[model samples]
Every structure is written in structure tokens, then in C-alpha cells.
Target: MRIALATATGAAVLAAGAAITTVTPAYAAAAIADIKIDTTVSFIPPSGSDSIPFTVKVNSPYTGSKAPDIKAEFWKEGEATTSAGHAASVTALSDLANTTPAPTPASSVEVKGSIPVSSSDKPTTSTGKWTLKVSAYPDGSTTAVSSDTATFEVKAATRVTSANVDPDPVYLKSGKEVDVYAGFHLEKFGDEKITDVRLESKDSDDYYSLSTGLEADDSYHDSTSMDYSTSTGSWQLRISISRATKKYSFTKAFQVKKSGSSKAKSKITLYASPSKVKKGKATKLYGKVYRGSKAWSKKILKLYFKKKGTSKWKFVGYVGATSTGKYTKSVKPKYDGYWRTTAAATSLTSGSLSNIKFVDVK
Candidate 1:
């Protein structure tokens, strides 16, 4: 009786040990061996709809009856490490599941999923770094077996939407100054600040350049003066704007026309009193300006002088005419010379030169 009892107890003990061994494989941890993101997706814009695709290699200890779940989570650089703000889930490849309780290599498969980013996810700052983690989980389990992480960048997008130059057809007259204006509008996705805004002529010889910053309405405006020296012909204005590391440029054509023919004719008369004077003696230089047949009052005249035998004329000074159209100035003559005056061109009147006067210094 003792021998039979011992044999039955031994058999029961062996049966229990076998059952425990059989249940061990059911709870083995699944694992994610590696994850690789598509190299083409180097960066994500701060404000837009984007899909990040990747591949995950997984080792599943579970039976072929069910497949493990693969999950991807995204975290910004400064976010807390405890949890991620975005996540995507996908099923592991069917072939990854183990058919038997034997050791097997990890299987690589493209995860048919995407981490969607929307405009609301835009960062307040110009740019930032982001991290992605991929993990594998067994069926109906809350714990992750293993995970792998990768990194990428988030940057703002900038562009210039519209631009224009006021007074498309610039009208220029001899010795007259004209005002020209330029304006621009810009659009941006993130908080990046505009670094520069400038306007320049395509031809360096045109000599027009201006710069300004964006206003509260995201607009830029500036003005420059054009005079007789400015060339009249087909011209181009190149507009450039910069934000962060990006630069945008645009070119626009414009016309500059000479309108001197439409201006009224002008005339000036000049004379030096005491035609013959001792050296270093004071002499009176006087002039009168006229527009057409009428007196040009409150006008400015430029005085010039040159030695009798010299051809180069030296600028003496400026003289303003009175309400009666007469101007005068006292000068001491040191040598025999010729003197003259000129009236600069105006929007309504053409330029004119006066008759020369000779001063003989003894």
C-alpha cells in the first residue's frame, strides 16, 4: 500500500511541474528591436498637416493566434518625459508572431500608420526639436515590451505674398526732385521675425536704394527721391525680404519719363557793378529771374565766377530773389574774372542761365 501511494504522489507532482512550464511562454515579453524613419522627411513645418511614416522591427513571443500592437508616440523637446502629446497605433506584421515556443529572429515591416501634425501643434518659438518613440505590446496588455526613439526638427515657413511701387510711371524734369514710394506684404506660419526688407534698382547706375521694417499690419513701406541725374528709361526694382535663414526676392519693371518739354521757359539777367575796380575792392553782383515773360519772384539763383583767361567756372554762392524778382550780393574782387548766375529748373519752369558780366581788377 505504501509503494502505490508513493508512486501516485510522484506522478501528481510531475504533472503540476509540467503545467507550470507550459504557461510560462504565454506571458513572455514582446520586444521592438529597432525603428527607422523615412529619410526624405527631414523636417516638419510649424503650421501644416503632415504625416510621418516609419518602419519598425519587432520580436513577438506570442503565438500565431494573435499579433502584437505597435505604437508610435511624439514628444517636443521641452515636454515632460512622463507622457507624450501625440500617438499612433498599428498592428505588427503577421509573420512576426512566433508559431512555436522556440527562439526566432525579429521581423522588419513598414508600419502602415502616420503621426498626424496639425496647425494647432505649431510652436510659439521659431523652431524646435522633436522625438518619436516606437514600441511593441502584446495582445490586451497595457505595458510596453521595448521601445526605440528617433529625432527630427520643426521650423517656421515664410513667404512674401504681394508687393508694389506707387507712381508706376515716374515723371522727371531737369533739376527737379520727384518722390517715389514702395510697399510690400508678407506672410508667415510661425513666430519667426523678419530680419530685413530692402528695395534696390536692378541697374546699379540707376542709384535707387531703400530699406525698412514690417509694420504692425505686416506691411513694409519706404520712399526715395529722383532728380535730373536719374536715368529715364526701362528700369527694374528688386525687392528682397528675409526671415531666419530663408530669403525671398521679386523684380518689377517700371518706366521713367522726361517731361522737361512741358515745363515753361525761364530766363535770368546778371551784372556786376563797378566794371573797373582796384584790386581787393568791393563790387555789387546783381541778377533778375523770369518765367516766360513774368518775373520769377521768391526764386533761388546759383552764382559762379572764373578767372578771365580760365575756362572752369567756380561756384560762388546762392542768392535768393526778392518779391520784385531782384537779387544782389557784395563781393570783393581779387583778380580779373567773369561772373554769372543760373536759375535751377522747377516742376513748372525750365532752367536758365544769365548773361556773363566782366569785372576788371587793377
Candidate 2:
């Protein structure tokens, strides 16, 4: 009986050792779910408008039976600008919905939809490239840990033909308001929506206002209006839009006469033409006044352009003012990016920026 008991005890110990050898160490926290955006461009015939048919691809390397849900979004590159750490002229194209998970590995999954073409989405600068971002969310978790991005270009349907701003010389007194008019036209190239009209001027003051659903009056094609009361003699008025995909713009100027009881006097009005510019090309800008069309003296007006992320402002040479109340300047860009410019006045008060505009460089 003692021998039998000894053999049984030995067998039990061997069994325990085998069990320990068979077990494995826990996998380092299932590598946060991974995902990617896969897309291809297809053109609608005759129209030749570029459209994206995109799908989200997910990978679950872990041994788990179920996968997590993923979310996604799309953004245009180089749409916003900044000067001295302040934000200006930020814009977007589209926001897409999150996709459900696929049931099997290596099986293709996609969000059911198409990116639309519009009049506003026409590429004005930098080949109009945009990026699509996709992110994954694990089930029952608020934290989204996994993400990926895809890059593509938006083709131009129409290029900006001409842009001008008005009132040769816009004269105003300090604390007095004036309406600056810009005339522009759009060439129907793509099918994107161009929206959200605005005028912005900033210099460490953080002052900005947005006007929605406003377009250049029907009477004037390719134009919009804004109200500005000059706080200082020299200031910049930036004209911007809400949506800019396939959107090209040109401007012509119109002035608001000055009113009395204003704190100061503005002898001239200066501003950017086409408000937006395409990178690497020379864009024409005009400065005008209301000194009764006698035109400001032919002095070279100093101007500068700066991108959103950097601290430096590039000096765009002095623009000569026309005797007919207009100052004309040409801007050539060194990089494919988004930028805004400010024009300083010599003896102006009520008028700073007669207007603003935008162009896509890439």
C-alpha cells in the first residue's frame, strides 16, 4: 500500500509541472486596434470633376472573436493662416461618418458614401491636396486610440480669371463705419460649395467677426460686402469664405464715403486682391481711395504676407498707387501654402482694409 501511494503522488506532481509548461504569458495589451484609409479617384465623364470613392480598412491581429468600431474625418491642407500667434482664414471641405466593423479579417469594409464635387471646391492653389483621417474605437470604451491618414489632390475645374477691389481711395474718419465692395466671378469647374463670407483684421488684439449666408450682391457678380470702423489709421481687412473647394474668386473695388464726427481721418484704403492666393504665383492686389478720384501720390506702399504656422512675415515690395484712386501690388509666393497680408497706411484713419480675398496655391 505504501508503494502504490508513492507512485500516485509522483504522478500528481508530474501532471502539475506539465500544466505549467503548456501555459503562455499574457500578450502585451492587445496592440491598440489598427486602421487605414484606402481611396481611389474616379472622374465623372464629360464633366471631368474629380471624386473620391474611399473605404476604411481595419486589422485585428489579436485572437479575439469580435472587433471594435472606427471613426473618420477629412480636412484640407493649408487652409488656415496666422500672424503673431493669432488664427486667421481657417476653412474646411467635408466631415464623414464612422464605419461599422467587418466580421472577418482580410475582408474589405467601407463607409457607404461619396465625396461630392462643387463650384467652391475648385483648386486655387497647391494642387488643392486634402487628407482623410480614420480612427478606431474599441467596444465599450470612450478613448479612441488607433488612427491613420490618406492624402489626395483636388483637381481645378476653374482658375481665377480676374479679381479687383473698388473705391480707388476709400476715405474714412476714425470710429466711422464704411462698406467695402469686391467684385469677383466663378468659373464652373467642380461641384463644391463655396460659403461663409467674412472680413478679419488682427494684430495681437484677437478681434474677429463672422457673417453667415452672405454672398456678393446679385447686382455685382463675384463680390461681397463687409463693415469696418478703423480703430487705427493703418490696419488690414481680410476677406474670407466658409467653404472653398473648387472655388476661385476675383475682386473689383467700391468705396464708402466718410462721415463727420469720426475720431480720425483716413486718406487712403489698402487691401489684398482675390483675398485668397495660389502658392508660387504672383497675385495682383489693389489699394484705392476716395480723395475724389484724384488718386494718392505715386508712393510705393509697403506690404507683407505670412503663413499660419510660422512667425515670419515676407515683405511683398511696395505697390504703386494710381492717380485714379487705386494702389496696385503683385504678390508671388515661395511655398505651396495659405497666407494673409496686412497693408499699413501713411495718414489714413477711417479706412484700413477696403476688403479681403483668398486663393489656393496648392
Candidate 3:
């Protein structure tokens, strides 16, 4: 019985070795499926320089009983075929493979490596796709059996899209507070989805936040208002953006002018009934002109309507002040569209326009 058991064990070992040698698994050689790599890259670099990071991974066939050894490398495609040494050069990362035992049943062996930016690489250049190829080989095999490849892009070092500061050069008086808005503009890498933004403002804690990630198509307004009421002087606004590791910055100066008693503040009060007005309909419009000290007593107010399709405007009517500062005019719509009315307060210098009321007429 002992002899029979020993014979069976020896036969089993021999059979396993034979299978590993003879069976050519589907992914037993260098093939595209045996490799993995990161497709996205981000970073910031000095002007006239370029840097990129990438990862390469090796994978073995899932169905093979004998785990395979794998090696990875990078190569240039297209015109860059000759630039990348016509093949991957062992720099920071080298061709390495996993030589350990399999972890579980149906599990494939794997290895990974990261390629960092090297000083030797072309600065501000190497603008093409670099393919990462992963190769696999069976144990005791002298050549690669399968391989896979991935691609990456190398770009310029410093990238500045729209770099500017807001509240741009304003004046404020001592003990006079004024609110100012700052804005920045930019466009890069074919409409980049801005991620991870940072702002550094001058005066540190005294100022507000910075604005980044402005949409290429839409205007970006940062609500960073400044108040120079306490101290009258000049200040700077610094803005910075860290998009995907690429940094850009700009700054502007503003001032606070000294002033005295506030000017007589005059307001034009606009009164419009049926705040919601639809197109193509007659509606009554009212406007009142008021000054900081007293109400406007007499003024000639004109009513005009511009149809949606045409640029020419027709004078619908006019409201001449017969009483105090109040004036009213009733007019009908020419077409189904939006209309606006302006009240020139000849009586007072304060001119006011009523809120745009939408008039929808069927």
C-alpha cells in the first residue's frame, strides 16, 4: 500500500509539471488583457517644463492552473516611436514581476509600478501618447507569452488660463465702508472640470476667499466684498487656483478714498401691478420718482413698448404728473413678448425703471 501511494504522488507531480509546460492558456503570452494602467493625470510644474505620472500593472490569465510571471514597460506610439528610445528605458521604474505563490484558487498573480517625472525627460515637450505594455510568461518559459498596453499624455509645465484679481482698483475714504466684488477669468485643456481649488488673499484674515473654477462659457463672480470704512488706504487682492495640481495666480490693487457726509441719497420707487405680466396683453404701469429729501412733484414720464420680433419701439402713451410725485399710464401690448418702461425723472435727477414684468399673451 505504501508503494502504491508513493507512486500516485509522484505521478501527480509529474502530471502537473507536464500540464504547465504543454497547456497554452488564452492569456499565456503578451496580450492587451494582461496589462492595466491609470488613464487620468494631473500636476503643476514650472514654466517651460513638463512632468507626468503613470502606473503600470501586470495580470495573469484567470483560467490557467500554473500562475504566470509578468513584466511591464512603457513605449512611445506614433511619431514619438524614436524619442522613447524606440522602447521603454529602465529609469525610475524597471521591468519586474511577481515570483510568489498564488494566493487563492482561480486567483491570478500581479505586480504594479509607478513612473515619475525624470529630469532627463524632455522639458516642456514629449507631447504624445506613451503606451505602457504588460507582458506575461509561464514559469520555466524563456519568452513572454502575452502582453497588454495603455496610453498617457505629457503636457507643458506651467499653465495659466484666466488669471486676474477683482475689486480691481477701487477708492474708499477713511471710516467709509464700500462693498466690492472681485472676479477671475480662464480657459484651459479644452474645458477642464475644475477640481480642488485654493485661494490666498492679501491682508490674510482681513480679506475674504479667492475665486477659482470659473466655467469657460459662463461668467464667474466671487462674492468677496471688501470694507475700508475703518482705515482709508490701498489693499491688494490675491487669487490662486490649484486645478489638478496645476497652479495659477494673479493679484490686483484697490484703494479707499476719504469722504464726508453721505450725499443726499435719492431713490426712484417703481410701482407695477400684476408683477407677473405675460406677453400680448394690455396692462397698467405706474412709476414714482422720489428724492432723498422730498418726493418729485412734477415730471414728464413717457411709456413705450418694443415688440419681441422688432427693434423699433412705439410710444404707447405718456403719464404727465398732474398731482404730486405719482404718475400712471395704461397701454396695450403690440405682440406676445416682453416689455420694459423707463421713467425719466425730469422733476428729480433720480431715474428709475420698473421691474421687468413678463407678459405672456396667447
RMSD of each: 22.4, 22.8, 19.4
Pick out the ten consecutive residues of candidate 1 with the lowest summed lDDT: 1-10
Q: What is the C-alpha lDDT of each candidate?
A: 0.65, 0.41, 0.46
The best candidate by TM-score is 3
Which candidate's lDDT is highest?
A: 1
TM-score, structure 1 vs. true: 0.36
| Candidate 1 residue-wise lDDT, 1-362, digit = tens | 00111122223323423422112224445556556655344234334566656666655434544566777788865786477557765554454435567545444344655666554555556565777777767677786655667676665445455667778777876778989887777665544455444334332234576775678988778888888656554466665644444345556677665675556568898888888899878999987887655567678899999998999999999999986678998899888999999999865468999999999999
Of 1 and 3, the candidate ranking higher by lDDT: 1
Clashes of 3: 25
List the candidate 1 regions with Cα displacement exceeding 4 Å: 1-28, 39-42, 60-62, 89-106, 124-126, 161-362
- In what order do the candidates fall by lDDT, top score first? 1, 3, 2
Model 2 Cα lDDT, one tens digit per residue, 24-103: 22221122222222222322222334445555444442234434545555665464312121111111212223346623
lDDT of 3 by residue, 226-245 (tens): 45432223345554545463
| Stretches of candidate 3 exceeding 4 Å from the true structure | 1-32, 42-72, 75-79, 82-107, 117-128, 135-146, 152-162, 166-172, 178-181, 190-203, 210-225, 229-362
- For the record, the alpha-carbon RMSD of candidate 1 to the native fold, in angstroms, is 22.4
